[model samples]
Target: MDTTVNGEPRVLATDAAVALIDEIRRDYPDILFHQSGGCCDGSSPMCYPTDDFIVGDHDVKLGEISGVPVYISASQFEAWKHTQLIIDVVAGRGGMFSLDNGREKRFLTRSRMFGGGEACAIPGVQKVV
Candidate 1:
């Protein structure tokens, strides 16, 4: 599937991320990420938003991970462009690429605790549904 963030296109995952995007696109009418400052693991997982969010410079705009619309920041997007974003199914499913000091960086999420949505674990590598 084609992944685009902030109107830019990039291949984030081999298939897992793409598949998820595809599934969400079909049934989910509203798609976006809940971005914040930090998390226990230095950053939080991207989640389906309950409201509208603005694309910011610090946010990574993920075109489509697993066919789901993901919005990240420009900084995060630039960081993961040339690196392989590893999608670990066990630690939850979706993905976002990041470059930490010129090296490929990856963020994976299964359950997000924001936006009035319950923290639900998602499929390991399946497309969003």
Candidate 2:
């Protein structure tokens, strides 16, 4: 699946991330991908089951990046509503999809803006293998 980012087209379905998402979907059809407010350094990416996984304000195709529907926080969904976003599936030692753009800034795991670190933790989301 390709989406525009920074006015350029980017592929969101990476081989590794897509495979992982497919496996997880077998158990949990509804999942969410978000970054924890802050962690050791800054914000960290999070993937897990969500009890309140609303579409927010984003109108992204749920099946584009596999059957697992993608949803963002209401605030985040609104923030990037105007900007084109590509959900690139990724996997590595660190985490999942990495938000790449000219602006390079680490996302804190326990960001105060994201409702602190305590609220960032997911119930069943495991690290991508």
Candidate 3:
């Protein structure tokens, strides 16, 4: 289902992802997600304890899922701002450093471009100059 930040829809998470988040929460009460823009993890969504990772100044808070804040880098956001991010759980290993690594299920990011009306409804979207 769609998750919003301050009532503005931004991201979505599958039921399996929500269940995994719930399970992860049992250990790390304060957790968050960051959409990796390739490199070691190859664009997977990484989950971490809130205290473990430092959110950069340029990071954008997309939304929250299961009460956990989700973020993406400003550069990544610029490239993906026109789309809605959907977080899904798939059978595999998570990012090496992510909390979900040992669970054998990784968080994947899937997205779809926002429709005209939907684009207008999202906050922070700007017209190309």
Candidate 4:
């Protein structure tokens, strides 16, 4: 799958992550990701069945990985707007309430800062203030 939407990608997934996502999709066809900001989950990416969690109006959609939409709270987006989120799978427990819970591995969020002259090109992401 293409890692980018237009010219740049705001989010991406590793091969392992894509495999895990495909495994999860077998059980839950419609799933999405929400990047938690240092709450109970300690900044891990939370996965859920699309209808299970509500996407708040202030949340920003950061494009898709493995065909699943990824989002972050508007507040968190401001803090991470300059980085590209790389979704990876690691050996550990997932968030207590996340769909990946109970699975042997969990989804992890890794990131890299955008280079000079490279701006966030994803649609719907606007500069806040």
lDDT of each: 0.41, 0.39, 0.79, 0.82
For TM-score, candidate 2 versus 4, the one ahead is 4
lDDT, candidate 4, 1-129, per-residue tens: 333434568887777788888999999999999999996999999999999999999999998887899999999988988778888888989999988899989999887687764654433332221
C-alpha lDDT of candidate 2 relative to the true structure: 0.39
User: Alpha-carbon error at 125 in model 3, in Å?
Assistant: 23
TM-scores of all candidate predictions against the true structure: 0.40, 0.39, 0.83, 0.85
Give lDDT tens digits, candidate 3, residues 32-83.
9999998999998999999999999999888777678889999998898877
lDDT of 2 at 12: 35
Off by over 4 Å in 3: 1-8, 116-129
The full ranking of all candidates by TM-score, starting with the best, is 4, 3, 1, 2
Summing lDDT over every window of 10 consecutive residues in candidate 2, give the lowest-scoring window. 107-116
Q: Which candidate ranks first by TM-score, i.e. highest?
A: 4
- The count of residue-pair clashes in candidate 1 stands at 24
RMSD of each: 13.2, 13.3, 7.2, 7.0
- By lDDT, the better pick of 3 and 4 is 4
Ranking by lDDT: 4, 3, 1, 2
Candidate 2 lDDT over residue span 1-129, tens digit each: 234333232113344455565665676667665533344423444455655444445344322345444444445545544432233332223333432211132222211122122321323222221
Candidate 4 vs. true structure, TM-score = 0.85
Comparing 1 and 3 on TM-score, the stronger one: 3
In TM-score terms, candidate 1 sits at: 0.40
Worst lDDT run of 10 residues, candidate 4, spans 120-129
lDDT winner: 4
In candidate 1, how many Å is residue 46 off?
1.2
